[model samples]
Target: MRILMATAAVTALTLAACSPAANDQKSGEPAPPNPTQTVAAPAEKPVYRFKIGALDAIALFDGQNPVPNDNKVFGVGLTPQAVAAPLTAAGQPADPIMLEIHPLLVRNGDRTMLFDAGLGAGKGQLMQSLQTAGVDPANITDVMISHGHPDHVGGLVADGAPAFPNAAIRMSEAEWASIRANPEMADLVRVITPKVQAFRPDEEVAPGVEAQDTAGHTPGHVAYLITDGQNQLLYTGDLMHHWVLSVEHPDWTVGYDDDATAGKKARLDEITALRASGAHIYAYHFPFPGLGKIQTREGRATFISEAQPAA
Candidate 1:
């Protein structure tokens, strides 16, 4: 449990939205060729849907990754046993913890916007999630990137081409620079460079979507604040990952943070801001369709998922 192990761990986070997603699979294994296995994915159930004034907001389910309760990713400065105690108390599995990756789709007038594309089309479930939501990639006029992490950017391109051909890839200038400078992400940069539209951290890339600089997790890490009339929802992108470990003990940093101290502070600040705003939040790495509100129970903030029945 090293307190600051950002350098090596940050490298692993580069190609992942969450480390578990990238670490879980063997690259060479192909999908089984059975006919039924290849059966076309249908327009499945809506992940989670609600409204933001005139805007139609939907949480698209990309996928989930379960990782062991190791001190590497989460709880960067504590033993696994220390982390497991919280899980066991919460009645959650104490061994492997689950992390979900879900993209958000918002419809404002003729403009269709997506907040961070998930792990590409075939590689993850972003496409199926989109299909189920009745949205076509071409209809997405804006792809608002929270940061340049692999999982968020992966679905931006597919098969060596821009996944959302008609969409403008928007991100903070600092974030774009970080991605562009990475030699390992050369291919990805090449594909999206032309479509990339770098803006200031707090710029309003779209009408109701204002990018709030929640830096720390990444240089230009941001959370989207979508406001329409009185309705609002915050798209929290990796500001915190685990629903419990993160919200309960945000002081416990994640190794993936490029700046661990700042990341922890960002979590505290976000929790305070969210509580003050009283706006719904979409946590990218919480449970699927992570739409929820923060409820301060007993003294600490806890997530109350509106998408889940028992919350």
Candidate 2:
């Protein structure tokens, strides 16, 4: 599903998209009145990095692009304004919403697994981000996908070829079937199917990694759980997108959900389970390097931004 907002309009209008003021403050950091003074020796922009026991996880920002905020993209009933209103109120661009597509790479022992390829070959910088993190695409042993959306699966093939030539591409059977059947995604499916390895729900295809069938967002939507003895972390692939929005109102369906009702149910259940388990979550669409925990407050679940602490 797609929601439209005009985030890039200011840039198109040439009204100072990124000024000294914008760049100096840094994201998740306080904005200085005149940040240009700090520009001389700027701090490195934060990169998402963490660990779950012995498993090391890194959030590689493949960069993001804006999609038109049309009514139908978000599914059937939701309007663009309805979704944009909250994000705008929260200080995010209201007209054209930017979707930050992050592809995660998890390293366990010698196994380097990349979760969701991101907007690969066509027009993203996932490779650069990976390199910045000291990871090579060829070093990725496994490429696990949560779904078949263009952004999620697009990175599988580059320039009409498999990006990770040495990696085994894995995804849900339902996702492969849906992508294959859709005329729009048929070409991508055809190209990636040769390398595509399908798996079912509740199955542990990888060592301590278990595939949990979340569904609803798309027919075969799934989440992966990584556990090391007692501690665990969950990679919720687009299961929950907007922070605060999804947590505050877990039932509010996004236009992207193929089955809104099913999405709502799965989200509620997953949030509950995640909270109870106290498992850290890596959300593909939560925010850049979307890493955080779900907290229960006021009888409702809330997404507390934990990647960077408040000053």
Candidate 3:
């Protein structure tokens, strides 16, 4: 899902729409401060470089966007206090949670592939980030999509046309089918169909990249596993959004998930498997350049972001 612009009226409307009538009594409680009002200092550079065996992987920071932090948006069955605990403990704001959008770039020899296209022109900083990374859209040989959400597919087109004209746009066959069938996504499908290369679940979309079925967030949703020799990194599309809530409370279903039950199961299973494998993960909606490893401590999974390089 795309990050929506925050406005007082819109925020109020969203909270009202998602919460039950019983929560209205809390209206007397002071409204939570809006996090978007506080602008973050601009990142000095948009590119975060790391290696996966011999392959070079780069995370391109698109932009940080704010979403309503109501319990309805995240912990549907839990209280705000429950959802806010992990955030507070992590030294993060407990209201108006900000989510970072980072599209990944993986280079293997002559192949240059983009994991996901970010929010389209005017909405995100994908193009600017690309320039900062010294990546030319024209030179990209492959455009692999993790899912069909706008944030993931928007950057695929620019000026009403495919941005990476020469590149093959890869998506799961099931996802392609869903996109074609959904009226809301018809326009997007039309623009990308020309280059769309639909593959089966678990199929290798590239030399070292395999599509792992992780449906639940959306019908036909999938994640990518990029393996370079014995090293691998899992590009989790939207399996989990918030680093804390999603990791510590895998059972809590976010409002964006099409099938909350399925999404919860997928999250639990994926985190367990990733923790066992000890593979690094790049969560799309986590912090910018969301590079981290999933670790289990006393039966709880936590996302530990890798330390940033010193300036």
Candidate 4:
């Protein structure tokens, strides 16, 4: 049943590690660049903006972070051929899987909010992207975290101090507990501990921002459903890393999940909910600027990037 509608990796070293870039002219003008093709960049340095109901949104392009597919990171229980099949179908190389790193930024009234800080200072182009977006680190009022992974929380600190000086660092209490005990995150914990405003799952931390539990990828994994009276958008943290393997094939187990069984169930359930509500999404690792909708066509639910030209 073809329901006509337009819209939208975890690889080896993925969960352990996470840029999205183009020289940029001005996006959202004449159809977005193909997620697969490398087109001539517009003058802007990879910053994209759009509206989510009434709030303004931006996709800060950090730069490419690719993870290897040859490793047992993606198709955990399946054969290598099973993993390669989707990439082959998508005409993408099966190894050294390509993914992007871009954190989402949105405005909630007068407050400036960032979702999932990018890789740390000097590690990725997060700072440059912020500059292109005309956002000053000091003015960020809130920093909402999806999880505590390095790639997601890397930019939270720099040189043993908080990076977003004025922002309230928010994350699930479970996630804060998960990382605080990990000795490997000792340095990071020391810096962010005082600033983290741990919230209960499903709690509304801010005006119009509700944390939806989607644990399994990590103990405190979550997605944000933000609405501004007229519309809503889901900021999918690390819920699904790869579009084909994770989004299209939600049943496939991912190596990054702390609990693969629960992770798979959450992935399927989230996809179903997205399809049912038809809300727009701000994907953490779908494609660059990962804005799109989930549509089931030919029995397969896919991420349809917003304003993408005919494929």
User: For model 2, how does the per-residue alpha-carbon lDDT over 1-311 read when each residue is reduced to its tens digit?
Assistant: 12122223211312221232332224465332111010010013324677788778887777555545564433236677776765554445544555567788888777899989888765767887787788878888899999988788878887787888888888889887888889998667777777888998789977778988999989999899988888787899988876656755567767788888998899888888877765688877755656656655434464544343212
- What is the per-residue lDDT of model 1 for residues 1-311, given as tens digits with 9 covering 90 to 100? 11111123222233332223332225463321110000011124435667878789887877666778888887877899999987665545556776767888899988899999988867678888788778888889999999988779989988899999999999998899888888988999999999999988776878888998988999889899899998888898999798778877888878889999999899988887776655688889875566766755445566655542211
TM-score of the candidate numbered 1? 0.83
Per-candidate TM-scores read 0.83, 0.78, 0.84, 0.84
Name the best candidate (by lDDT). 3
lDDT of 4 by residue, 167-215 (tens): 9999998999999988999999999888889999897888889999999
lDDT of 3: 0.77
RMSD in Å for all candidates: 12.7, 8.4, 10.6, 9.0
| Residue 94 in candidate 3, Cα distance off native in Å | 1.1
Q: How many Å off is the CA of 1 in candidate 1? A: 26
Scored by lDDT, model 2 comes in at 0.68
lDDT of 2 at 63: 57
